[model samples]
Target: MTETVEIARGPYRAQLLALGATLRRLEVPDREGRVANVVLGCRDLDDYRRVARYYGATVGRYANRIGGARFMLDGREYRLPANDGPNNLHSGAPGFDQRDWALEDADASSARFGLTSPDGENGFPGTLRVEALYRMEEDGLAITLSAQTDAPTVLNLTNHAYFNLGGEASGRTILDHVLRIAGSHITPVDADLIPTGALRPVANSPFDFRTPKPVGRDIAQDDTQLVRGLGYDHNWAIDAPGRAATLYDPESGRVLDLHSTKPGLQLYSGNHLADGPPGTSGGTYAARAGLCLEPQLFPDSPNRPEFPSARLDPGERYEHRLAFRFRTAGSVDEAFG
Candidate 1:
């Protein structure tokens, strides 16, 4: 049975749908606690039907990329749809991001969704069953994913939520926000944005975020990676003893810290955003107006032997957890002062 959980904070309201165990919307207070729905999402069920690009949604069955829409398993080559150029992106033609999920359970603070994929779905070789959990805590939100397969299969999952701390329709870009990534290297991508299977040091490159820096500081640098992706859309290799990457908006004293066990985090500055569609904030989205921090295995991990394996087999369960904790930097009186 499908269910919905309502989480409210003042005039802002969020609905967590048990279907697919997704955090469908998160309407929250901005810098002024003025109540803004910052996350990119659809206004209603019909809007989701018309939009294909998964906004504020859960993505799975391989969340990143697979080279040539094909991979060899046990000496057998499996061909996927090759949706992105010469490579397979986000799990071929009909990825899980757009599928309707079964609701397993739900409560005031949490929800769970489940789905079973028949063997050979999307050219993958396995009967896979996956479940995702969405939890709303006092701090922020926590997403937990688990999956198992009757046969060996690759899996990677992530939530694609676009955030704008200044409030979604505030008409300000994310240029002024400060970001700090706890990493020393990054997985360098090829001309087509596929990982070259090599982890390069972020020491001198613009990818370095050892210390707090503005995302736009060196985004326009004449670097190959930046030029290829149009901005910061590649994954950063997190340092060992992994913890969380942080983003702070001084204007609102709002901070979002992301913690995950995943090896890589893709920082997308929303360079492809356009004003073609109406957003949840009741305003047209402009480029660079928001950002996405997706934690997961490296792109094309099935093809990269050195990267962490994304394979799930019978009796072996795949699990990962991510937390997005929100906090205020100052006291209420001081913040208002």
Candidate 2:
């Protein structure tokens, strides 16, 4: 049976749904103690059916792209579906984000979803078993992803949560929010936004966030990657081990701290957001209204040797953790300070 885990923190209430093992909603308080849903999500399963972009969903098998939808495994070429132009994005034509996962366990603070992918399901040569655990604590939300393959294969899992700290309907762009990543180099992408197998320094470029900077500070600059993605959608190589990146909203005095064990973090400023129908809060989503910080292996990592490996073999368990902690600041105190 499907289950829902509801966890509460002050005025904030979060519901972890086991449908796809997704963190469905994260309601947090705004400036006036009024709670608003900050994460972008679909209200029902039908909404996800119409839009397969995996909003607030857990993506797996491979979270990003695989070059040309083909990869060499054990000296043999495995061809996958070319879903994203000429590359295989987020696994293939039909990834695991939309599949109904089994609820393995659930509690007041945590819930686990498990799924097994048969061999050759997406042209991957292995029987992959994966689990996604969502745990909400008084401090924040913690997501732990683990997977094991019966044979050799590639795996990269991440959550696609679009966050707007000022509330979804606050009618403000994330440009004013200050962001700081714990890395100096970023994987440059090609014209199609696929990694070009080069780790370039973020110095003197819009990718640089060594210090706290607003996302819109250099987003519109004449940068090739920015031009390709239309904004910040490339992965930044996180140099420090077990470090956390932070985004602070000065207006609401809310801080979102992202801690992860992954080597790279993809900072996507929702440049393509548009007002279609109304959203959860009956607000129209405009461009740059939200941002995503997906912590995982770099995009097209299987095709890039210099990047961290995404290969999973027998007797090996792939494990990674990401935490999003929220802290409130008093009216007189600085949010970032």
Candidate 3:
């Protein structure tokens, strides 16, 4: 395995690897001027390859779930690998997360990684070309993803980074992290965690994050959605793509402002993160050890006509922009200000 590439600017520093175009480390400072590694992962690249967990990697051909591991495209049915029950999760096993990307360019402030997927690979049509750009600005990290395919194919790409703002790998969880999402609706999943093809309102449910609230505030409610997700694994329908969500850690005084152009944000509470390898921060992680806020198109969008389309044509190019604005402040307003 090759060495990881690191980029630094101001108080923000990040480590990137060509393997899956993954982010090996992301360090940010708090109000006391003390820095902590917020992103969770092992120190070795082999651990990532063997573990197969998305971690801080760039996940694609399709980022989330696809119902029945199948989709009908242009009157043809395509069957994908059933890696997640009867559904396809993160493009199935040995998907993008397990592949090594080629380094197109690298510098102190940014680096670009690229991958080319052949037709019929992973049971998806088209030869897909994808690029991921990781840039370190003065206050945040920006990732711009672009893709093109030789044939019409479904694609939804996103970074699967698990975050722990409270600054510990063991007993410290994300329960106290105050989070606010600009979503008024969500694409609820079923027993298999596949979207039910409905964009239901979040007005009176534990899924509401329009206003700031603790992550564990309603996670244990008797709601069926909560029970189905195990925590907050469902995708929240985001309207203002400019302002997708905002998360703050009272203990560390660290704030992360999420900005994306995607239609949905998957807020996973790391319910199934148990029995994982020891983290770089030094602990055997358990459930709720971290939280993931993945911004992308809705899961199972290929089969859901009502949701935004994820199809890319021969002459068309797909582009997505995501930014995690980080700062040390008392509240969300100060972080943005």
Candidate 4:
């Protein structure tokens, strides 16, 4: 119900809401010259709050799970609200996804949202100034997340956008979407979906996405990890630094190339997307309706020393870049590089 920003260029158009600095709509053209909304989202800001919490919002403080909802930073233990069973999820309830960011700047092709998180907010020890910048590029969107803290604390930020490149309301599930992850190893998780602090080879296993494969091809196989996540909700360590993964929809001839500076990516196959309100694209969402490619620090990075550190101290500026480039079948290769 507030003022929303719009970005348009070429055949792409996106609507961004200041509430949560969330992406409300993303439309691109298919091969047939017909445009379709590709991202899942609610009809209004109220629906976004009552139903799916993340949707197309920027999630943070710490983006993923932290074991036991607590972690030790510099010999000091920090306890966060247990939003996900016994673990901290998306920085707990009332997270950044629930806040309305200040509209710092906007234009025809980009928008900038800013927020300041005080020390002790979300149980993190820092007064952090943050920014989520969106820039519409030649064939895709680039998001830059940056932050600076006044105290030592752990932080990981990411955009949680559920995408169905076949067109969000095509009444077609994303099970047939082909995906290629840039990693051969994935962080295994426990029954509660918390990382077990071990990176296991996906070779010859159902977790293998080293090569291009359909999401539903091996999704129902009898596997412990799949059972725990209800589908695929694990993080893949990036084998290639600049590029993390790619998703292609053969039916619609749409492709998404993911390039990021983060070390890992959480590939979630919208297992719990049901019971949501009507989507902006006139579709009622259900489980596995869309998929998320969240590029960020490893889950529970603060607790697992083996993972890349997510600590930012006084005067230290944190910055990361992520881009999701959209292209058609024939131009996917050239657009990606």
Candidate 5:
């Protein structure tokens, strides 16, 4: 059985599920004060089970991909189940996203879901305990993912929630949404979508989002990286740790400011978000219907020595905080000014 938890503050609200500790729904008021669900989600638990797209789900013991479905940790090579072609995605098949988390605690304004992955689970070598806390604060929603392990392990967790500021079921694409990422370099990927271990400059490429631009502006450019991922599916090695990215929908006047503690941000333009599963708008979610600003560690970080370490040892804790602030363009201007 799946349990639902609702949290709201002011004009912002969110609904969470026990399964995958998923964020099933998020409603916020637009410029005209009309509240609508802005995140893509299935109509029911059965639908969620059918759609493995990871909509609003909390992903992984190691989010993103692990090259060759294997990594060397403390000199021991551990192999994981290859789910995404030749790489391991979101830590294999039945990862944290597929597990049922326990509702450890909840209140009117906050909820905490916990999950424990036994040692050797998904080929990871640790008895990891994770907690996802969703708190409705001020004008935004804060999500803190923290974990501890009894043994040394590599962990990279993040929420895989797609956003469409115009509202999820509006039958609209996010191509027109304006976006800004706080990184000057992106970890370019190979044909297999795994990082190439090189921090390529975002300048002179369609991947640049430094000054804020429409997501579709140069998306159709004849760039090799664009052809590789099919769209913006690579990770940006963020400039700093604070605010990572910003997204705004002109039509709705809704703005989303993403602040994170992580070192990397992935700008996924919903390149493959098509087919199957009816959305909240009672229609099939089309390609590019939503986009994900996933704040996480660089993909394939376990194998990249130059990247920040994702290793967690006994008595140590791994914590990642992502704050999504929602407001209207007018309000944003006032706040900034």
Candidate 6:
């Protein structure tokens, strides 16, 4: 049987699932004190299994892509299952996101889920032990993903939670949401959506989110990058320390600020959400139904020699700290301060 846990503090609440340690639901109050779920979710665990979009799942043993489903580590080339075109995405099918995690602990304001990946699982080295911890704060939620490997391997973990500040069932796309990312450069990708190994400046390009603007403003442009990813599906090289990005829904006055310890942030515009499973609110989601702000190492970091390393050796611990603080536009200082 599947298990779920709910944690709350003040006006904030979150529902977590044991399957993939998924974030099933998140509730926070709007400007007028109206509370609602803000993250996209499936109607049930069965739907999550059939959908395969990674919705709200904890993705790993490597978070993003591995070029050609292979990477060289310590004089050995490890091969992985290629699921995303000619590349490996989210560490291939049956990835950490598709596993059943054990509910290790839970309380009124926090829950911890654990899982163990056998060596060679998904063609990844190391018998990895992992944990996904969700803690509810007065303002929003904090997710910490940590893992340890018994052998030399590559690891990058992150939560794939898509956000729609206006509410998940608001019957609207995130095109109107104003977004601001702290990075001035992005890891450009090729036609197959794998990083080209170059940190290209976002200046005067549709990829530039350094200044706040509507998500739909330049999304329809004929820019090559936009055409390749079908929208914004690239990783930004984070230049800030504290908060990495801010997403705001003007209509509802809801504001979400992202904080992360990772050097890269993947801004996926939910281009393929239309093909996802039926939503918890009852209906198939449309494109751009929500947007994902995934904090992790750059895509294909395992193959890029100059990228921030994703290598983990025996006795070494890997950790990714991600926090999402929600509040109304009028309470930015009160919520973050």
* Model 4, TM vs. native: 0.97
Please write out the lDDT profile of model 1 over residues 93-120, one tens digit for every residue.
Answer: 4677666678778666767778887898
Cα deviation of 303, candidate 5, in Å: 0.6
**In candidate 5, residue 163 scores what lDDT?**
97
* CA deviation > 4 Å runs, candidate 4: 330-337
* Candidate 2 residue lDDT tens string, 224-298: 789899999989999886755788787887778898989989999998877544566666778888899999999
Tens-place lDDT digits, model 6, residues 49-83: 76678889999988888899999988998999989
TM-scores for every candidate against the unseen true structure: 0.91, 0.94, 0.97, 0.97, 0.97, 0.97
lDDT of each: 0.76, 0.81, 0.88, 0.88, 0.90, 0.90
Clashes of 1: 1
Each model's Cα RMSD: 3.3, 2.1, 1.5, 1.8, 1.5, 1.9
lDDT of model number 5: 0.90
lDDT, model 6, position 289: 95
> Which of the predicted structures, 1 or 2, would earn the higher lDDT when compared with the native?
2
For model 5, what is the error of residue 63's alpha carbon versus the real structure, in angstroms, after optimal superposition?
0.5
Residue 59 of model 2: what lDDT? 86
RMSD, candidate 2, Å: 2.1
Model 5 bad stretches (over 4 Å): 330-337
After aligning candidate 3 to the native by TM-score, how far in Å is the CA of 330 from where it should be?
Answer: 2.1
Candidate 4 residues 1-337, lDDT tens each? Answer: 6558999888889999887889878898877878998999887568866654598899989998999999999899999999899999999867888887999999999999999999999899999999999999889888999999988999999999999998888878899988889988899999888999999999999888877889999999999999999899999999868879989888888888899999999999999888778888666888889999999999999999999999999888899899888888744343333
